[model samples]
Target chain A: MCQLLGMNANTPTDVMFSFTGLATRADEHKDGFGIGFFEDRGVRLFVDHHSARQSPVAQLVKTYPIRSDNVIAHIRKATQGRVALENTHPFQRELWGRYWVFAHNGNLVDFHPRLHAAFRPVGDTDSERAFCWLMQELAKAHAGVPAIAELTRTLAELMPTLHRHGTFNMLLSNGQALWAHASTHLHWVVRQHPFGAVALRDEDLSVDFAHHTTPKDRVAVIATEPLTQHEAWTAFTCGELKVFVDGQPLG
Target chain B: MCQLLGMNANTPTDVMFSFTGLATRADEHKDGFGIGFFEDRGVRLFVDHHSARQSPVAQLVKTYPIRSDNVIAHIRKATQGRVALENTHPFQRELWGRYWVFAHNGNLVDFHPRLHAAFRPVGDTDSERAFCWLMQELAKAHAGVPAIAELTRTLAELMPTLHRHGTFNMLLSNGQALWAHASTHLHWVVRQHPFGAVALRDEDLSVDFAHHTTPKDRVAVIATEPLTQHEAWTAFTCGELKVFVDGQPLG
Candidate 1:
């Protein structure tokens, strides 16, 4: 299976520590890797068909401290589409004057929806097609940019159709809120206030979050599995959809 | 004034040498810098609100050698919009299932069009507005991606409306061909057989094209001004629009 990593923070925070953990897992998922960083209304997306284990782009992401409020990343194993740069996640598109970033883990058997609207997939991936359909449906469901709660509700209503096809584990962000949907394996954890030292499960590297973060800093990380061994990671129930804002899951 | 650099090659080629020259000019045009590389149907866009001279992303771009068939780069001076990532060029949008990249050099005065279509400007800049308007009109003009000649003619018809507003020197590409329109200053050069050593105008960098290029390899480089010291760069006349495919301009 491919690997997915997402971060949502109350303040602009760097994901260097978490990304390093994810990159170590790129040995098996060597098809491609992509990461998107949201700086307010703007987004910076870096993708490579090369593996995160060796891609220079991934090296930059590991070293550069690009502080962002929301981030989505994926290391692909190429379940369906060919291993091309266009087919790498997370895919990006502009809708309602906001750039949306999406990354998917699980595959769909035959999830081809009619894309008659403005949103179209440049890549030949079931993931991108599903994303375009979601964008098209979202555009049709609302005339303008709707409120976050309304958008979340609309997404909740729209998730079942996609989940019915197959494993629909996905992470989506519009620089406002991050919405995560899982049909299979997915986990999340939040770190706040009394941040402690954390060690990566895949690598010997560890980070003292207490030294890097303030007492008020809050961060939520979602991944295919728990990246850190000691963290209180919570697994998502099958067919559950959750929205995260300000580093916490919304009720 | 901002600086613009575009390259369309018969084969996938790297622009590190030419981009180094452009980065040298970023001393004056230091609001931000962005470069978009078209690798087949995929695009790698790197934008930084910091100057290219100091940005780690730009440094990685300089050293990584990402080869592309079509490239559009801009180093901004921020005449209209604030120094923000959303306002950085070249702006990108998807139409007809192809990714189109655009970067503008000159500014416009009072050029606002009704953006009722799917295309919308995320940044508050006349250039982006003009680009959005162009995409809107192009979508309305053709049901799908048109032939290069037909698209060029439509652009020729569309140039005057934008040029009348103010200077409108711009470059656009959709991974197939590169289209450049000029109202003030724009130049292009084609380098092919018998490739010789060339020196950058601003930087001390020099490269011998004969070592890296084959006899049949052809490349066309477009910029606001000539990037090299010894090259036959042709200047575009007022209201002139040219389309380049496979490293040579089409009449």
Candidate 2:
């Protein structure tokens, strides 16, 4: 199985350290590696089909420093398709006058759903097909950007239908709020005031957030596994969905 | 806010298509993107600090194809860390002779847990700290490989302790099974025989997995959100955990 990681915050922040460990699993050390993040106005992405452990680019990524408010990252292990650039994770698109990002962790049985005019797939994997369909549905539901509550409610209703076919765990964002759903397994955690020091699982490193940010800053993290051995990481039920904004769950 | 995606299968599968859509939101579109997967022997990874929508590498990922049985993917909006390589998600490590992959989507407040071991952080993100703590705990719990049930129970006991500090939702895998937990929000779904069509949420695409897999194949997906418009995606309850192996949840 593959791995996933994500972050949401009340203030703009960086995810360099967490990403450093994640990149190692990509083909660089074992498989390829990829990352996506939002900046001042747009999104940035980097991917290498080569193993992250072996790739110079992956190494560079570990040393390079960048920051943002929302972020997503992935590492690859070929299963359904050959290792190639076209099959990387953390896909992107334009929707509702803003950029939308999506990533998935599951296999579909025979997911050949028809598409409307709003969304389309650029790859051959089942994950991409599902992304396109979601965009299509969102477009059909509203002509323009909808309220967070409305959008989330719609997604809650649509999620189960997709889960019926196969595994359909995914992450989605529009630079405003993050939406997460699990058909089988997923986990999350949020960090806020009273900043503290933390260490990494993959490397012998740690940092104190209190030294970096104000007490007002709030942050949320979601992943396939708990990053820390000491901290509590909540697990998602078999069928649950939630939306997050500014490091807090939407009402 | 950031996004996450994942897939688990009874047989080998690929997540290229799903990743394609997810990568788009990293920088120009979202912020950053990363993906992780488990191969036959180890974990593989791919990540980029660019947006999946505009990064040349992101385009290549969509065109290049890679497959895997277990996969995880993410897209970023940079709520926690900088836009550099070190901050990407889907971090990895080696445990028990197998590659263990982890990714996070929430933040911790004042989470300065002191490490008893040498685990450290490579970046300035809180996610890395959590990853390290988890590894430390695992190392302390089992000197060598332990039974799945034992490991699961140990994790269950550890979870509440970690949750006390803040929200903790995450995913973890050691190329054997995928474990997920939810604190605020996460979702999942299982797919088995009698596969069907699935659509995408970010793009226009679809696939028929029934045409591609054997009847014995079973798969499970976990994510921060649902990726399809026409399928059923289950949501995880607050503070729940589940494990998926060979496309089915372990009891």
Candidate 3:
């Protein structure tokens, strides 16, 4: 299976540590990798059909300290689409005068929803098709960008239809909040005050949050699996959909 | 005035030389800089609110050697928008299953058009407003993506309306072809067989095309002013709209 990683924070934060953990897992899933960083209303999306383990783009992501409030990343194993540049995720589109980014971990068998609205998939992946359908339905659900709670409620209503097809674990962000849904394996952790050093499960690298972050900083990270061994990670239920805002989960 | 640069080629070609020439001019137009490169249907967009002469992102563009068939780049003087990341161009949006990139060099005065369609300006800039209006009208002009020739003809009809507002020099690309329209200053040059060495107009750097490009390779480059010192550059007439496909301008 492909792997997924996401972050939501009250302030802009760099994801070099977590991304390094994710990139180490690229050994198994070497089709492609992509990461999107949301800086206010703008997004810097770096996608390569090359493996994150070796791609220079991935190297830039690891070394550059691009602070963003929301981030979504994926390492692809090519379950549904060809290993082409156009098929690389995370996919991005504009809606309601803002950019929306999406990345999927699991596979869908034959899911193809009606894409009647303005959004369309440039790629042939089912993930891109699902993202387009979500944008279309979101556009129809509101005249303009509605409240985050309303969007979460609408998305809650739409998730089951997509979930019925197959595994639908995914992460989405519109720079305001991050929404993550899981039908299979997914885990998360929240780091706050009194931060301690943590070690990566797949690599020898570790970082002490106490040195790098402020006491008021709060960060929530979600991944297909626990990225670090020492952190207290929480696993999502089989059919859970959660919305994270400002580093905290909003029920 | 801001500066514009564009490239359309018969094959995927690295843009380091032309972009370096453009970056040297960023010494004055240091409000921001952006570049978009199309590889097949996928695009790699690098934008920074910092000057291209010093921004780390711009440094990556210069060193990475990412190749593409179509490209659009801008060095902004911030004539209409704040010097923020969100306001940086070339602006991108998806329409009819294809990503469209746009960058404008000149200004428009009191040129707000009705934006009743799906495309909207995320940034508060006259250039973005104009681009959104163009996308909205183009969506109305055709139900789906028109042929390149048809789209160029439609743009030819649409340019006069925007040109009358003020200076509307711009470059647009949809990965298939590049369209350049000028209300004031714009120039283009085509490089083909028997390529020779050329020097940058703004910098002392020079590169011999014969060592880098194949005999069959053809490249069309568009800029606000000529980028090379020795090349024969053709200046666009006022209100002229030109379409380039496979490195050649279509009559």
User: Which candidate achieves the best TM-score against the true structure?
Assistant: 1
Put down candidate 1 lDDT per residue, A198-244, tens digits, no spaces: 99999999999999988989999999999998999999999899999
Give the clashing residue pairs of candidate 3, or none.
none
lDDT (Cα, tens digit) per residue for candidate 2, span A174-239: 777888888776788888888788776666778887898898999888877667555667998887
For DockQ, candidate 1 versus 3, the one ahead is 1
**Model 2: per-residue lDDT, tens digit, B1-251?**
56677788878887765665455334443566777766654344666766667654455456654556778776766656677656777776444434567777777777777765534455566776787778778878887668777888877877776677677778887767787888876778787788887777777877787887789988888878776667678998887878888898899
How does each model score on lDDT? 0.94, 0.71, 0.92
RMSD of each: 0.8, 23.0, 1.0
By the DockQ metric, which is better: model 1 or model 2?
A: 1
TM-score of chain A of 3: 0.99
lDDT tens readout by residue for model 3, B150-233: 999899899999999999999999999999999889999999999999999889899999999999999999999999997899
Q: Name the regions of candidate 3 deviating beyond 4 angstroms.
A: none
Error of 3 at A130 (Å): 0.2
